[model samples]
Target: MQLRIKPYNKNAFPLKALLIKGDSVRHWVSEIHALGLSLSEVDAYPVPGSSANTVFGCFVLLHSNKKLSDLRMHEQFQSVRDLLFIPSFSTLFPAMSEQELRKLFSSSKYFIHPETGLVELPEPIDWSELLIVPVEKCREIEKPQDAVFIPRNVDRFQIKAMPPEDALQEMEDQVFPKKKEFEDKPLNLFEKGKLLFYKLLFTGKEGKQGMFDGSDIKMPAWLSKLWPGFGGTWFDKMQEDFADLEERNKRKVDKLMEMLENDPEEALRYAIPIDPEGRGRGQIGNAALDFFTRRSNFSLFGTDGRSGSGYAVDLGDAMYDLQRQYIKTAEELKRKGDYEKAAFVYMKLLKNYVKAAETLEEGHKYNEAASIYLKHANNKTKAAQCYEKGNMTMEAIELYKELEANEKVGDLYLTINHRKEANIYFEKVATAHIDCARFLKASIVYRSKMNDPEAAQSVLLKGWRAHRDGNNCLRCYFDNIADTKELGREINAIYKNDVSEANVDNFLDVIRHEYKKKNELAENIREIAYEIIAARSQSDPSIVVTLKNFNENDKELLKDAVRFKLNNKGK
Candidate 1:
């Protein structure tokens, strides 16, 4: 039977199955919903079966909290023959074992009568009657045209079987045949004589000149019969060698004849006219240099040294003319691994101190590089970094200190195990942070590096009083408080001294959140909260109104304190 199956929107639920009933389309959506499972439903259709009968069914897409291997059909359903499990087209199926398939045929859950609390036992399903469709065949439901037919009532699903070991070997043999096996046939007299003749007259190997020189391999008589000009390779090699020798002799004779016919003055262009008395000083050396530079095609000479290249009357007056040559020379020296000389050329000739310093760094002359960076380039930061690279700690420390880089100075001192010196620099950094109202960073430095919690608290309190914006600092301080009585004192001091009519409500809200837990510490904090309410209530009558929606326990205590403080104010 042709069935029209299509992909549905429930791709998220990977475990899906079609419930087919040839009799009628029966939906157990409500029964499945009773198990509190997430399910998606699709339109009903006929299922291909063994009998020529129209089947009707809908698909139920679902995900089980249990693993796919552990999933089974709900046992409460009565019609076991109706369910047909298919792979989802939109979602990929993991491997399903035969046992998993059988378990899925078994029911998953018991149906309970919700109103009467009656349990309906599941009907058993025949495991043999269930169809085990391969996931690949089922997923073809994605293509509406090809999804029409799925074979049923088969003994086994048409899964692609792996080839047997011997079969695989036979296939491999056909694909990659073994080399020609050994065979023997005794030669007759004519064949044997012809083979011997060809071996003696025609065999040769290709020589270094790419001509066939000589070898023992026999040539076939057919090749000789096909081309009349194709003599054996040995004869060809001898002819080629003789021709080459004759060509060499002809070239030599032509060179001699041309030399005899030429003008003699042309030869003197490269010859030095020597004075027997040594009167012509530098002539021979100049002639050699001209030859050498000409052979180099003037690549070795600068423009100033090249023939017919004019220069300024005063060469020093136009220094820019020499700049390009200096740059090219420096680059050549750098490429040739002469970095020190390259640095010298950049510094003295080009006046490029940065390039000089970088070149010296490449040469690993860190001390000289650092000096050039500081004195010529005026980059003290880079100078300090260079000194540090060279392990010159003292020089780096001085430069960092001069630059007001206290953090680097401190780290440098710590590297040398000078803890006291490091702390001195760290204190400078912390003091600078405090001056800029960076109380959080200053507190961290004092607490973590200096190991002084009291100084940290003092800085946070100073910041709080000056700017009224150190809530984070205060929270950090309170989080580190381990001792209960010290916590009480700190809380009491903040409540009594830190409150103003404008900020008193804010402090109250902070205390309420900070000490919300019910414990002895919180009880003490609550009493302090009431004390602050009492003290502030005498001055600002509206403080009690702010405590209206406070924590129940603290609000009651604060209200009593406010009444007592107002009575005292009246007296």
Candidate 2:
């Protein structure tokens, strides 16, 4: 009837089901595991695959009966709501589905098994550190409609159901019954409304807490699918939590606000955790930091933008941290379609980037900036806003291009793929780039990435349009240029038409003539020397040529240092 299932580390959580001799449990365990839960051992009975016909059932993990988190998670076990979790399954067993087991191979929460569920797998444990880190959510996920190989959230990818609106509504409807079994309804309508409201928001159907409450409630997928506690989601209790955190933080902020008048040192001294509503990563605190910095600056110096010793200066660490967080959060927000906030946060990063770019080169400073931009691209709508702030956006995109971070840059492009604005800026940047390989790559991307060859060619043409259409000044400097003859004719035509810059052909002709003369001088040295002597002074470079010719008859000139031999080597 009750079970306790807890593991100190990632060890197996044994399963033991207390049932009659004919309880028919094996098929049941297999089904639950198939749905994605971990299973280890079972008590006295054989329940691995008991049923031949049945497809699914719960894996039974027993730990000295049942703990509250476990019991509350099940169908009708409500008695142990107050018990603390302990890991002794002497009379009970640990139960999990095959899917869960495969995803989390070891019964440990630290490493998730591949076939398991969707929570992002956390990094490995550091032996040097004692604390355990939670797994990160996987960026790679797919919905039913998405191509099997492609990640979800493309233009064609539909949204996955997370607690479909219907579930929330159905639970809501139950609160206001036509006629309740109880005689007393409420002392006041407002009170009744308040009670119903709290119930609807905090608990799911059958009084299930919609969140983790330090309890071991292994929520079934059926229920969790309805109340998704995934990344960046706002649950029913979020507002209430925001309210309470806000109240405590409010006084600190007010003090911080006042501190803005005189001491920013004191303002930052207020410490992190300033805003409760601010999830660990966000721009909320940056706004607070900006407020503090501006107030301090204004109070110290006149509003004319002059600084004095009296001005309160913040190290601006808070701003930096908040931006870093926002850089991460903004991307997440975009993915979730909280576009307004995501866009606003991205704008915040752009402003910071401007400030950062002032102190460092755009290329180097963009390293950090681009990371934030990456998350921005995870959601296209947010990227559209950032894309407009020319400098920051261009800098961000340049870094993305250099890295060839396709998953990111490609997706960002998807957002702006159809926009004229996107086309214009991309063309400008593509044209500025010297690598034709970049053009070729973009060409390849058209076919492979978004599956649009027209887009690829358009991108390539923009990149190579100027280079391919004309001979380069550098290339014309070389005599080996193949189009010299044609180019010269073009030059003559241009000259006849009174052109400003010389035509490519004329440049090539000059280069070619120089090469021709050099070749003749090398082959007909005597003639060149004769001509030189006839036209020039008593002794010139021609004299040297004559000496070299005479040297052929001197054996000494051929000796060691010379090609001619000495008297002993006279040949």
Candidate 3:
């Protein structure tokens, strides 16, 4: 019975399998089919017990115990020689375990999936291992028309891997051979003097021979022969060159000083050059730098005044130019994403703390900005602002308190809904602003945020004490009171302990007006009014007769006046 085998396509499985040893070829073929692997027709064949010997175009199964050497001599096997070979382990080496077989073939490359019973060729067969049989005795074999032979180069394959460092050293040894080492000997005094003299001359303006046509100077040919050695003629020439350079530099220095007096800003343009690499142009460069430093009053290299030179010049213009240059350099550094270096230049060199802080803030470096503002700029308010902007509320509040900005402290506390802390700051604000009559703002904060009416009332009362018009302030307090009953009780308590007649009269009028407006009940008003009049009668004795005469026509008023006089008769 022929099994219904699926048609083969290279896209489904591009790899081909070559199976050897027919002893278990039937079982191996079944396993390969179960793995859904496509096999080349040239390499695959069906065994007797294999399911339905229907052959696909790719898989080739060889059912024979043929050695690789014997198979390579066959024309059919030659076409699929390059394809992957899978030989049954048991058939190839009887009584051998999988581990033993793998160890025996360790030098070769192969793949094995034990779970799927899948295997591939460990290595290509060695053609030289084949037997050399005579053509007359050998069986005739037909080769495929499209078969292509590929020759392997043994020398191209490396058996062992080389480490990178070892390979590099090997290449270096081949390219650069070792050479003898030479030691340097020190020069004598005359040779050293000649070297210094030549260096000075070469680096001087006169050394730039190319700059002037027909005015070039050259060392004598005999000097080259003697080279590093110095003699009387070389020494005289060196001294003459030194003297000429000195005179020229002195003239330049005089001109620079004149510019410093007339056009100081322009003098900055002609200031000494700073060679960052320290490649000095002999004595002139050093002398020019010293002159500029002294003129600018820079104490970095120590002033010449203490040395009795007293060559200090006005540094105002130079200092200004340096500050501007530093600011420009810092800005450029910031633009180049070098924030740390930029901050250092701004803080250490320029000392422009405000600009540094502003730059930090612009860069989203809030914590650093706050620190600079606090420590360097000494602006606590701005520091607190920075902290608050950065969502660092606790830090901001602490700074605000340190600055005595109580209102800001209270506002911050209130913003975070820390009512208890808000109330504490509000009370502080109320106390601080009491004399200024600004305590009411704190009272508003206390009432709205803390919901403490009594605290608010207490703050308002303290403010009213410091107010010039106590009567108007007291009236205003009553008008704005949250609870009218609470205000009435507070007023009753104040009036009961009163001793001054003028204050008593003011309280009486307020009570009367409040009673008329129904802000205070009739009974409480009457009691406070009696307390005020009795207190006033002690200072002015005619108060009793004036009240009796004024209320003579009103029965209730007359009765109340007599009751008041009788009640205060003991005092």
RMSD of each: 32.4, 40.1, 29.8
Steric clashes per prediction? 8, 53, 13
Best by TM-score: 1
Each model's lDDT comes to 0.51, 0.35, 0.50
lDDT of 1 at 213: 34
The sequence of per-residue lDDT tens digits that candidate 1 reaches over residues 316-351 is 212242344456656766777766656755664355
Instruction: Estimate TM-scores for all models.
Output: 0.35, 0.17, 0.34
lDDT of 2 by residue, 1-571 (tens): 3333333343233222221122344544444344343333322222222346532223233334333333323332111111111223321145545564445434332211112321221232232243344888879665666555854555532222212234223322442112212122212434334434543444543334322242322334544687676423343344454333323323343444454335423332222321223332223321111222222111100122222323222323444545354456545545565443333333332333232222212323222222333442343322223332333444335446555543445445555444444444444444434354355544444445545555654554444334342233223222222354553443344334422233323323333343344442233333433343333323222222333442355655334323222222422
True-vs-predicted CA distance for residue 91, candidate 2, Å: 92
Q: Which should have the higher TM-score, number 1 or number 2? A: 1
Whichever of 1 and 2 has more lDDT, that candidate is: 1
- Candidate 3 residue-wise lDDT at 126: 31
Q: What TM-score would you give candidate 3 relative to the actual structure?
A: 0.34
Pairs clashing in candidate 1? 73-107, 73-108, 74-107, 74-108, 74-109, 75-107, 75-108, 75-109
Q: Model 1, residue 300: what's the lDDT? A: 11
For candidate 3, give the lDDT of residue 499: 22
